[model samples]
Target: MKKLALYLGLVILMFLTSCSSSKKMSSVMKTYEVETMGVGNDGTYLIKVTDYFRTSDEMVYLDGLKRDAVHCVIYSGIPAGNGSINQPALMNADTKIEGYEQALNEFFEQKEYLNFINSVVNSSKTITRLKDSKEYRISAVISVNKDELRKYLIDKKIIKSLDFIF
Candidate 1:
C-alpha cells in the first residue's frame, strides 16, 4: 500500500511540473501596425510595425530593390499632438528632406537591423516632387517577410504592371 501511494505522489508531482512548464511556453505570433498617408503627391506616410518588441525606439529601412538593411529609427511618425500633416516638414531645413540620392546613401549605413526587418517595399526617403502646382511627399515603412511580400505583389498582379520610370 505504501509503495502504491509513493508512485501516485510521484505521478502527481510530474503532472504539476508539466503544467508549470506548459504555462511558461512563449507566444510565437508577431504583429505590425502599418499606416500610410499621401497628400499633393508630395505627402509622406509613416508606417510603424511593432512585433514582439514593445518599444518603438528603432526603425529599420531597406532598399526597395537591393533589399539591404539600414539602422536608425529617426522617423517613427508618432503624431505630434493634434498637429497638421506637414508637421514632419515643420522642423529646420537641416531636419527637412534630403535629396533622394543623399538620403539613400545615409539609409544604407544602418544595416544592423536588417535581419529583424526582412524587406521594405516602398522608398524610405522623404521625397518631395512638384506636380500640378502642388508638392507631394512619398515615404513608407513596411514590416513583413521578404518572400511573402514579393509573392504578395506578384499574386496581386501589381508587380507585372509597373515599369521603372526612374
Candidate 2:
C-alpha cells in the first residue's frame, strides 16, 4: 500500500538523521583541549578548556566550554600543568563511548553537566576570531566537582567504582 511505503520511508529517513547527529556529537566531543590549572577544594578541579565554535553567542559559547570541560574530565583527562599533577580520565582511553552513547547523549542534552560545574571565571574568559574564518576560539577556567561527577558516573554504571580491581 502507498501509505505503508510512505511510512517506511519516513522511518528510514529519521533513523539516518539520528545516526548522523550522534556521530557528529561524538566527533565534536573529541575536539577540545584541557589544561590543569590547579586543584580546587573538596575534590574539585580547576582547569582551562579551549574549543572552537562557529558562533560567538555568549550562551552557546559558555555551554560549549562547560560541555568540553566535562567531556575532558570524563574521556581525555587533564594534562599536568600550573602546579597540578596529571589526572587520568574517569573512563579509560581505550574504552569506546559507543556503548554509553545514549546515557551520555541524554546527560548532555538534558544539561546535567551543569550540576558538576562549581563556577566559571568569566574574568578569565578570552575570545578570538580565527584568521579568515567565522569560527571563534574561546577559553576559560572552570571549577568542576570531579568527585561528584565520578560518583554519578559510577551510579549510572557508565564507569566502575573506585574500588574495582582488574
Against the true structure, whose lDDT is highest? 2
Off by over 4 Å in 1: 1-110, 121-128, 132-136, 144-166
- For model 2, give the RMSD to the true fold: 8.6
Per-residue lDDT tens digits of candidate 1, residues 43-130? 2323333222222222421233122211122222323322324333111223333343343343345432243354354445343444
What TM-score goes with each of the models?
0.20, 0.78
The lDDT values for all models are 0.35, 0.86
lDDT at 59, model 2: 98
Residue 109 displacement in candidate 2 (angstroms):
1.7
**Candidate 2 weakest lDDT stretch, 10 residues:** 22-31
Candidate 2 lDDT over residue span 89-113, tens digit each: 8888444333677787789889999
